[model samples]
Target: MKRQIVTLPLSLMRVTSIDWDIDWRGAPEAGLTDGNTQVVMNQVPRWVGHLDMTMRDDWLRSWRAHRWQAQGRVGIYRLYMFDPLGFNLQAIVGRAVAETGIPFATGERFSSGSGFSPNVYLEAAAAASAGDTYVTVTCTDADLVPAPGQIMSAGDWPMGVVSVEANGDDTYTLGIQMPLRADMAAGDLVSCMATGLFEVDDDLAGAAPYGKLNRSAFSVSFREVLNR
Candidate 1:
């Protein structure tokens, strides 16, 4: 897997909020161009994101020097936006081109700030044998058990968790959508997601801060390269 961990410009004191949009194009049925008669076909889904965070001067300086304005014109950079949430791409190209370069941002309030959807991960408490419908798992204080609707895998085979039953002591039985492809042993690795953000085709778009304040904030926008 080609991936890199990027620390935030600053450990965001607080993530005021994060917002994003997925756009689609609709073609009106052209027989008569009726306003209500349009087929809303989702085009290649493109994601645009915005983040608001409490910033630090050091981080702001770093952004200005490297990320926000690497060159006179903004340069492209890979952003691992959701590693904290485990939404990462398992495989990526080292030099995948981003779809767009950083565009300029107009900071309001001298304002700012910030920064994949991937398979999910579930912890294993106990192992299971072939033909067993339920599997046990040990949750790492930070880990969660496989939940219904998430596709999980042990070895190379993948199966969806259809149901989950909590049995106490951090142990849970996961009902897979399909029969096990092979027996899972205790301590086996299980996961439904790959790690890393979607590879981008172009450099990330850049935003420049308008004014300096004790606390900094700015917003950068970009499109993630799509991988299916």
Candidate 2:
């Protein structure tokens, strides 16, 4: 069976600083061995990584108002060992920071393996060693859409649309909702023509720039298919 996953792409606004904390603790003993050997294991300092991001207000506002329904915010953020790496994880961390209404100053700490780290070093290392992993976040308004002529599929079924939007963000969100059936599955692929408007950075406007807004064809995978 096939399903769809809808997601929002989050731009890396900027990294204020990268930081970490190390903690040393003893491990629990398994049991007494046959011999009188009490195997004392070495206690190593565990390292936790953190990345503080100062996001632009425009980006945060656009994401909250249009994409996530105002789910997350900005603040000092930390990531553990097991969190999904890259844009997916960062988008979520951004949301959490936004939702808690926490100051952009205080940081939150989590265990290393709970799968919620946002540290760039760790993420890069993980990505380098293994093939890139895919992470999904709530759909955002500023997300880029798949362009026309882009091929999307639901399982093995190919899809087609009239147009598409290309915001250049990781995930594709529709500026206007499309006509879809109610029985869509969670992992189903959606291929359609997409078009939308986007706010470009001032710096990039001069080079290879089209307009304050441009229309284009795009393609995206659904993170979660919504039930009608």
Candidate 3:
């Protein structure tokens, strides 16, 4: 594949919130005689996203420069949005927890422990056809597992996690919010979706009071482009 697709940095996802929508094809139509109007709809859909982030004025300045470098409103940058529900993509502690405790003279004990879930790579375990809701995947990352509510992409097709079930053989079955859009093979990359890709095809406008005070002050618009 050509390197036409540019991946945005994860640091760009410091958004306070996002306003996402699906831009499906539609047209207003009216009966010639009665003048009754109706919206003619085509189910072809694309993602329309609005991002709001608070950052230093310098950062916002650089963002504007980046957009200018792209010739304004004509750039394809791959963006990855984070999961809304916290810890849904984080590592889950196993059924056991090991802690070392020491008794103190104050009648209080000190127990120190640690649990962290860093980013890890993932892949599918079997070939799956388009329209399949769940796909089996294997993760070599120890103590870390994919969880429900995480949004990910496979073969460049976006999907959200609805369920995660373990198969007892070091593999997992993940139910996706949207079924596969195309067939995928075994060993294909099943990203946990910490990546970024945003195509700028619209105006980058926002009302950032005092540089970056309001929640929606610094906002950028992105439109998902599949074949643009």
Which is the leading candidate under lDDT?
A: 3
CA deviation > 4 Å runs, candidate 1: 1-14, 24-37, 68-76, 82-143, 146-206, 210-214
lDDT of 2 at 155: 25
Return whichever of 1 and 3 wins on TM-score. 3
* Cα lDDT tens digits for candidate 3, 34-78: 776667876445556787777545444544444555544455666
lDDT at position 107, candidate 3: 46
TM-score of each: 0.40, 0.19, 0.64
Tell me the tens digit of each residue's lDDT in model 1 across 1-228.
433423232222134665433333345545445555546564444444465655557555556555534332233333434322322222321112111112234422122323211234455667777667777766643335455665556653445567878777766777863456568878787764312122223354434444546566655554433342
Q: For each predicted model, how many residue pairs clash, with residues at least 3 apart or on different chains?
A: 26, 40, 10
Error of 1 at 78 (Å): 3.4
Candidate closest to the true structure, highest TM-score: 3
Worst 10 residues of 3 by lDDT: 93-102
What's the C-alpha lDDT at position 11 in model 3?
Answer: 38
Evaluated at residue 92, the lDDT of candidate 2 is 38
Candidate models: Cα lDDT each: 0.46, 0.27, 0.59
Superior candidate under TM-score, 2 versus 3: 3
